[model samples]
Target: MSERPVSTTDLDSYIADLRQLQARRRPAEIPDHVVYPAGEITIPAHVSHWAAQRPATTALTFEGTAFTYPELDDLHRRLAGWMADQGISRGDRVAVYLGNSPEFVIAFLAILRLGAVHVPVNPMFAPAELTHELRDAEPGLVLTNRALASTVEEVQPRLDSPVPVLIVEDGWADAIAHEPFTGDDGDLDALAALNYTGGTTGLPKGCQHTQRHMLYTAASATTATQLSAEPGFTSLCYLPIFWIAGEDLGILLPFVLGGTSVLMARWDAATTLDAIEAFGVSVMTGTVENYLELMARPDIGERDLSSLVDPQAVSFVRKMTPQVRADWAAAAPSSGTLRESSYGMTETHTIDCVPYGFAADDEDLLAEPVFCGLPVPGTDIAVVEFGTQTPLPLGEVGEIIVRSPSVTDGYWRNPEATADQLVDGWIHTGDNGRIDEQGLLHYLGRRKEMIKVKGMSVFPAEIEVLLAQHPLVESVAVVPTDDPDSGQRPVAFVLPAEGATVTAEELVSWSRENMATYKVPLVKVIGALPMTATGKVRKHELAEDAAALNR
Candidate 1:
């Protein structure tokens, strides 16, 4: 549906008009928490609370500038008013296509403030990739930075209806400089966010999460992490905000607790260290590769990391080795509570299984197989038979199925896929796991093939689809190979066209131009791809071959 476009002058004029009339609710009356007091929770409740209770407190710090709680609230709500003035209301989708910046957070808050669904589009996506998600989400408005606006412009002509794109200039000061939106609170049961994740079929499916689902996740995370309002928590937001896990920690968890998320322009080990010392950064969540880089730094030991506390970090893809843990303990000894973070996916809102109280020496971290701790509040975990609902014995390895209040009802607009992954309110997470005798969940690995490159989700099918588009490429099978730094790297086995002379470097160069750099595969010119009897590409065999070739 087409939406009314709004201008800065229009928003100001509308606010002046509203000043003459009275409304049912005022912004000051809104509560501080939307997560707690369970039944009465909304997406923007926490922002209102923090803005009222601790207006001057630093809510978010980026580069060298900081936005206090009230400052952030004022900007977001006014932006919401501007959107509302455009008749963009509940159920309308708004795409946030910016990087990890304050603009991303403000736009996200504004969308939810208007009861609109938040669609966090990946900033790394190319035109082909961007078109797929925009087509599916059907955003009425697209919020992007100046540098990325061209990508949106490129994809505009290809969409069913061209979305109105707002390129942020000077922190959207003029765009949001109006009276605040003191409209009604968000409906907890209504759709709030659409987190897009790549599937086995090669398309990114949106995981439709309601406001209540977000509330439950925030509540579970609060209890699990022991977050409180007394002394506000502060963490780094170097992680990609588009990803569900990153969004939870960076935006959801921090705001829900009235804490500050010091945002970095990008990941730099020295800068992360500087932030830790500079901002008294309390918690840290990152990859094993990130930890290695920090530990590898000779000056890391010299850095004052006393403020980095209660760090039960989440190291993804490759497991965090004991040596790495020992190194961190030795280097940053002040981080006493270092251990595994939580277990979750986009559909379940990440934080499904939380290692809440697990310490460094606890069996939770040193388990034989990887441990995902216990299920969060109002969530149940069952290890079922592979591809079936039959409950397996506690020790038997099976597919981990989760039934949680926080679980998404289904994928957005895809009933067939919803039926395949979600059954009877139980999310069939295609992960290999088992319940130990002590009732702790131990994760084995992925039953389905979803490769992770430096903690970024990279589907083999998506890579293969992109590679197959090459003119010289007859057929391609993408599989994961061992990577010391990135955990796992995609290795493509390409069957070239007859008499075609295409170098491996040419295919790699082509892939770099098409997809995200992390998703780009190391091209290998092969005579044929291993196939099943039905002529399907045998990915597992190709994976083994890739490992052998790497060795």
Candidate 2:
């Protein structure tokens, strides 16, 4: 098969362009220093800088509405003053249950400005799950959309601890009066946000990150990916602000860099395409599935997407099929625009990203699709094999360990789980990857997702990719189940392409022909595959459904 069309000048051109852009903008040849002063990391600081530099420039454009830098800055200051007057003390956690809107950004930044940690509650969570997080965080207050207040109220009376809840409604009277109140500047060392991630034992654990941690994350990400606006650059904010990748790059980084952000409350293929052409969006970050959906649209080819600097960003580790990579490069030429891939977990502040594509002579960079690039400035990374716990040689697949100023201190009060994951000051990134001779990183799989079949280790992601190539297969989710006889067996749940059909036997035969016998799933179900909001298949749910099907 012919190799996919890719820009040979990818790395060379990117470095040259970025270096030139930096040099012309900065008096010194050094990379532009993002000044994040000590003592307090507040939204007010970023907003103030942007307001002073580009007061009239649009800061955010959401659903046909726009807010300039000064407008957003004024709102932040006023909200902060009101919050301080209402006695929301520094370091207090405040839950926010709101959709993607102007108020969402205002509320989040306002909470940060008041030196309060914002607990971003998942809007999709059930009342029980929502209540549990709220109770655990024990936030002093909650800022919720008027529509979601009922859910909060329903869970309120049942809680052992109650918190004051305020409604965020446009044109409504402020819950905290506009009267000014003096307050202390936030201590940057203080906690900034508490994001919940999956626990090792299948429970939710909060990851507390400080201002410096978040700042470092955003700075490093922007630097590594070269996320910039270049005067009229526009970015599509499709992912929810709750996701670290979306919030850091889509929202926070734009403001810090004085860039225009176009927002969408939800993802709709046709609407997303229309918005891209209408708003002249230059960049967007989303999964390959999203790009596929947009491209499948009948009118997509006719749409004027030349304004896009990158068709979209792809996760190499999650969706790194040779076909997928080829499709992306063809759609957005590496020399014309870049779709950089990134590697990082929630704990490390979502740091580390590498520009995409490799040329004939650039064999060094092509060694890993999960090339998160070299650690940004203060970060460190090491690859160690699983059994011996010894650092592995470059090019050997192993666990990717990291230590950085941005790494979380520990999970919230979970000492046992913390001890198991963190070792010798390194956060054992539950992720398996390898470093190439040229220093690029490649992700293999997550430790937790490793499946054991007949005493052999198998990665579901590897199997899923092969299954996805089948003509009838629209998507696939794989998991391991105990077989009583064999230690475990691979089981797959598949979603067929619309209007197409495939039997379990035929699917199994196809998989057998494509993958190794051990890797082939013994149990196969043809049906819809459950997915998260961000388009990642919820493998745990599929596994449960698969078990029930066999039973």
For candidate 1, write residues 106-192 as lDDT tens digits. Answer: 888888878899999999988778888999999888889888888888988989988887788744777788678989766778898
lDDT of 2 by residue, 46-160 (tens): 6767787787888888889999988877776677777776678788888878777777787777787778987887665545556667877888888887677888888888688
Relative to the true structure, candidate 2 reaches a TM of 0.72
Candidate 2 — what's its lDDT? 0.66
Q: Which stretches of candidate 2 lie over 4 Å from their true place?
A: 1-41, 170-172, 175-177, 180-185, 228-230, 315-340, 356-372, 385-389, 450-551
